[model samples]
Target: MSTTNTDVLVVGAGPTGLLLAGDLATAGIDVTLVERRPHGLGNMTRAFGVHARTLEQLDARGLADELLATGTTLTTARLFGRLDLDLTRLPTRFNHLLVTPQYEVERLLERRAVDAGVTFRYGTELRGLRQDAEGVTAELTDPEGTPLTLRARYLVGTDGHRSSVRTALGLPFPGHSVIRSIVLADVRLAEEPADVFSVNGSGDTFAFLAPFGDGWYRVMGWTRTRQVADSEPVDLDEIREIARKALGTDYGMHDPRWISRFHSDERQAPAYRVGRAFLAGDAAHVHSPAGGQGMNTGLQDAANLSWKLTAALRGTAPDPEALLDSYQSERHPVGAMVLRSSGAIVRLAMAHTPLTRATRSLAAHLVNAIPPASARAMGMLSGIDIAYAPAPGTGRPSGRRAPDARLREGRLYELLRQGEFVLIAPGGPAPALPSTAPVTAKHLIRATWTDPAKRTAVLVRPDGYVHWTSN
Candidate 1:
C-alpha cells in the first residue's frame, strides 16, 4: 500500500520494455520499469539475428558499433531450401545480418536506461491496472509479496506472449500453435559450418543451428512424431538424430550446456492500445521463428512506440491523440504481415502433404532464378523494404523510413541521436518555420528528397520515419 508516481510506467524488462524505457529516460522523462524477474539480463537467449533496419535504428542511437564488435556479420541468408537472400548489395550501411544472443541486446538497452537514471523495480509483478482521464494506476506486488500502487501519465506493456497487462485490458490474442515440442539446446559444435546459419527440414522433421559469435552454438529441432508435454525431458541422442535427419550432418555436435523444449504459436493482440495502456513486443504479436524476426519485430515496436509516448506525455507534440493513435494504425499491420510471412515459411519447411512440398520446391527454384524476385525477398526478410503508407491526405512519401545519407556536417543518423524530429533542407537556406513547430530544422544537409526536383524540405521522425515533405 505504498504509492509512487512517474511520467511513464513500463511493464516487463525484456528487449521491448528496456528499449522504450531507455528512449523515454534519455528524453529527460521520468520512467519506471518493473520486471517480474529479479535479474535484468540472462545468459540464455532465443533470438540471434539482428536485421538491417534494426541495425540502422541502433546506429541512430549510437549503440550499433559496440554490438557489431561482439557479433558475427554475414551478408547472405539462405531461405526456403535452395533460395538465398543476399544482403551484400542491400542499401544500408549494415548490409549484413549480425548474429548474437538476445541477451546482448538487453544488456546494451539496460545500460542505456540505467545511465539515463530510469528507476527499476525487480522481482515485481503487475496485479492489475486501471486508467482514467488523467493517467493510469498500476497495482503491483514486490518480491516480498508486499502490495504497491503506482500512478503514471501512461503505462506500456512489453511483457511476453502471456501478458498480464493485455489480459487485464480484456484483449484477445487470436492465433494457434503452429508447431509444438521443439527441442532446443545450447551446445558447442565439434566443427562449425562455413555458413553462418544452417536450416533444413522435410516430411515431419526440421532443424536449424546458428553460432553465438563464440564457439558455442544454438541448435533447434522439431519432429512431428515426438509431440509430447512440454515438461517431458528432452534426450540429447534424440535431438542429435532429429538434427541429422533434417540436416545432412550434425557437424559433430556435442557438449550440451543447456537443453529445453518449447511450442511456437502465431498470435497477435487485436488492439495495441486500450485507453491509456499500450502493448508492445511479444505482448502485441508473436509468430514462427523461421525468419528470426520475433525479437527484431518487438524491438522495432519499441522504437516506434517510445518516441510517440514521449511526445504525448511531454505535451510537446502537435496533436497527441493523432500521434498516439498512429501507433496501432502503423504497427498492427506490420504484425499481421510478419505472422503471415513466417507462418508460410514454417508451413513450407514442415510440409507433410505432397502438394505443399511440391509447391514449396517450385517456389524456391523460381524465386532463385528471378533476380528481381530474389532481391525483393531479401529486402522483406532484411527489413530494408518496410515502408509505411501515408495517412489520409498526407504526402505519398510521408510515412516511409528515411534512409541514411551523408550530410554537410556528418551522417544522417548522427543528427538524430537527440531523439527529435529532423527537417532536411538541402538546396539552400531552410524554410523558416514557427519556433513552436514540432520539428527541428537542419539546413545545408546533402541528403536527397523523395522528389528531388520539387522538395524544399523533408521531415523525419525521431524513429527515422518520414512524417512530411514540402514540395
Candidate 2:
C-alpha cells in the first residue's frame, strides 16, 4: 500500500465538493478531491433552478456571469399552483432564478477548481476512513484498482445520499421516504407552453416542467397509482399519461433523450461533524426537491465550510475548533428547515382529499393577497433572508448576511474575490476587531460606508456574512 498526504480530503466531486475544493485551493490549501465516476457529466440533470442567493455567492467568486449567460432567467416562481413568489423584487443583481441544468453549475465550479490547482482524482473510490485526534486515514482504490492510502488533517464528505463517508462514520440518516418512484425525463416539446416553468397537481398525481435553455425540457411527474419498483422500466406513455392527468396535457412531449425513476427522502444526519471528519451536501441532508433547493443548499454549505477549513489549516483562526463546530450548528438547522418546507410542498402537491385541496386553495389565496407574506416566501426560497445569531460577547450584529452594495472602489462582492474578510468603518483606519475573528480581515474603503451618521465598524466574513458590527 502507498501513502499520500494532503491538508484536506474532499470526497465526492459533485457541486458541493467542487465548490469546497475550489475555494480551499484558491485560499492556498493543499486539497485533494476524489470522485467515483470519470471526468465527465451525464445528460441527466436533477436540479434546474439557481436561486438568487446562490448566484450572489457565485458572483463573489467571479463565476456567476458565465453561468447566467448559459441559462434563462425567470423572475416569477409559482408556488402551490396559485401563489406567485415575485423574484424580480428581491434586492440583488440576479433578482431572477436562472433555469439551467446542474451540469452548468458543476462546470463553472470545476473550472475554478482546476484553475486554482486543486488535485482531482477521477475513477477513485473511498473504501473506508479512520479518524483520530491527530488526523484521518482514508483507504481508497484508484482507477487501476490499486490499493492506496491517504492521510489528511480533515475530511469532508460531499457525496450524495447513500454516502460512503457517512456510512463509514456510522451517521444515522434518520427520515422517511417522502415520494417513491417518481419519473424523470428530458425531452423535446412540440408545443411549448406560455409559461417557461410550471408545476401542477391533480388528484393523486403531480407534474412539473422547466426548460433547459436549449431545445430540451425536463419533465418530472409522479402518480400514486403508478408506484412500482425503481428497477422497473418506464416508457414515454406512462410519463404522458401522468402529465395529462396532473397538468391537463403532456404539451406534445416527445423525442426522449433520457428517462429514469428516483425516490426522494427527507433525511438528516444526526450530526454533520464527527471528530476530524464532516458531512455536507446530500451526504449531510436529503429532502424533497420541491423548491429546487437540493443543489443550492449544498453549494451554500461548501461556501460556508471552505473558509472555516482554510482558516483552521492556515493558523489564522482565533478558535479553530469553534469555527469548525459552527459548520454543523449553522447548517443543520437550515437542513431541517429545508426538509420541513420541501416536505410541506410535497404533501400539499400530493393532496387528494377535497378538504385538503380546499384548505390549500384558501392558504394560497391568502399568500397571494398578502404582500408581506408573498415577500417572505420569495426571500425564503431565494435564500436572501438567511441569517444567524450574534456571536457571544462580540457586541456586534453577527449572523446576518451582508447585503451587497456599491462602494467607491467596486462592488462589495467583487472585493470579496480576494478571499479575505472585509471590514467597513465609518472613517479613519479600521477599528479593532474581535479577538475571536476567524480569518484575516481587509479594511474596506471609507467610501464603502453609505451612512455618515454612524461611525461604527462592520466586519464581513469571507463567506459574506456579517461577523460583527460595532454600533
Candidate 3:
C-alpha cells in the first residue's frame, strides 16, 4: 500500500469536483481529486443550458467567453401550449442562456484546474474511508488494482447520486420517483428549427426539443399510453416518433451522440456533512431536469463551499466547524426549493386533465401579461436569484451574489479572477487588516460600473457572494 497526504481529498472528477478543485487550488490549497473513470471528461451531454448565475461564477474564473463560443446563445426560451412565456425579461447580463453540452463545460473547468496545479488522479476509486478527530483516511484502488491510502484534513463527496462517501456515512437519501420513465436522445436533425427550444403538449404526451450547434438537437418526451414495464427496453425509434408527432415534422434523426432513459426522482440527503466528510452536488440532492438546474445547481454548490473551506484551512477567521455548518444551512433549503419547483414544472407539463391544461394555459398568459412577474419567475428557474444567509455572528449581507465589477485597473472580471476573498473599498482607503487575516483585501478608490458605492467597503467570498459590506 502507498500513502499520500493532502489538505482536501475530493472524490469524483465531475463538474462539482472539478470546480471545487479549481477554486481550492487557485486559493492556494493543496487538493487531490480522485476518479474511478480513466477518462477525465465523460462522453455524454447529460446537461445542456448554462444559466445566468452559473455564468457569473464562471466569469469570475475567466472561462465564460470561451464556453459561449462553443455553443449557441439563446435570448428567448418559450413554454409550449396554447400560450407561451418568453424568458428574455430576466435581469442579467447572461439573461440569455448558453446551450452548450455538459462535457464542454467540464473540459474547460478541468483545464483551469490543471493549470492551477490541482492534482488529478484518474482511474482511482475510493473504496473506503475512516475519520478521526484530526482528519480522514481514504482507501483507494488504482487503475492497476493496487491499493493506496491517503490522509487529508477534509473530504468532499461530489461523487454523484449513488455516492460511496455518503453511503459510507449512513446518510438517508429520501425521495420518490414522480414519473415512471422518460426518454432522451442527442441526435442530428435533418432540418433544424429557427427556434432554439420548443415544447408541445397536446395529449397524454409532451415533448421538448433544444437545438445545439451542428444541427444537433436534444429530444425529450414521456413514454406513451402504455405503462412502461421495468423489463422493457427503451426504443430510440419511439423517442424520435414522439418528436415527429409533437413537432409536426418528419425530420430524419441520425448519428446519436447519447441515448438515455431517465425517471423524475426527487431525492435529497438528510444531511450534507458527517464528521470530517461532506457531501455536495448530486451527492446531496437531485431533482427533475425540468428547469435544467442540475449541473448549474451542482456548480453553485462547489462555488459556495470552496471559499469557506479555503478560509477555514488558512485559519483566517473563526472556527472551521461554523464554516462547515453554514454550507448546509444555506444550500439545503435552496435544494429543497429547486426540487419543489422542478417537480411542479414536470407535473404541470405532463398534466392530462382538461382543467389542468386550461389552468396552465391561463397561468402562462398571466405571466406573459406581467413582465416583471415573468422575469422574477424566470430568474428563479435560471438560478440567477440565489443568495446565501450570512454566517452566524458575522454582520454580513444576506441572500445576494456580489455583482461583478471592473476594477480600478480597468481589468474585466478582476475580482472574480483572483479566487480569493476580495474587499472593495470605495470613498476610502482599503481597511488595514492584519496580514494574518484569513481573507485577501483589494482597494478601489471609487466604484466601477457594476459595483455601486452603497458602502465604504464590500467583502466578497470566492463564490462571488457578498458576505460583508460597510457604509
lDDT of 1 by residue, 105-192 (tens): 8889899999999999999999999899999999999999999999999999998999999999999999999989889888888877
Error of 3 at 464 (Å): 1.2
**All candidates: CA RMSD in angstroms?**
2.6, 1.6, 2.8
Error at 57, model 3, angstroms: 0.7
Best candidate per TM-score, number? Answer: 2
Off by over 4 Å in 1: 40-43, 432-455
Ranking by lDDT: 2, 1, 3
Candidate 1 — worst ten consecutive residues by lDDT sum? 436-445
Off by over 4 Å in 2: 41-43, 441-447, 450-454
Worst 10 residues of 3 by lDDT: 441-450
lDDT of 2 by residue, 297-393 (tens): 9999999999999889888877899989999889989889889988888888888899989878987898889988888878888888888766666
The candidate scoring highest on lDDT is 2
Better of 1 and 2 by lDDT: 2
TM-score of each: 0.94, 0.97, 0.92
* Candidate 3 similarity to native, TM-score: 0.92
Q: Residue pairs in steric clash, candidate 1?
A: none
Local error of candidate 2 at 309, Å?
0.6
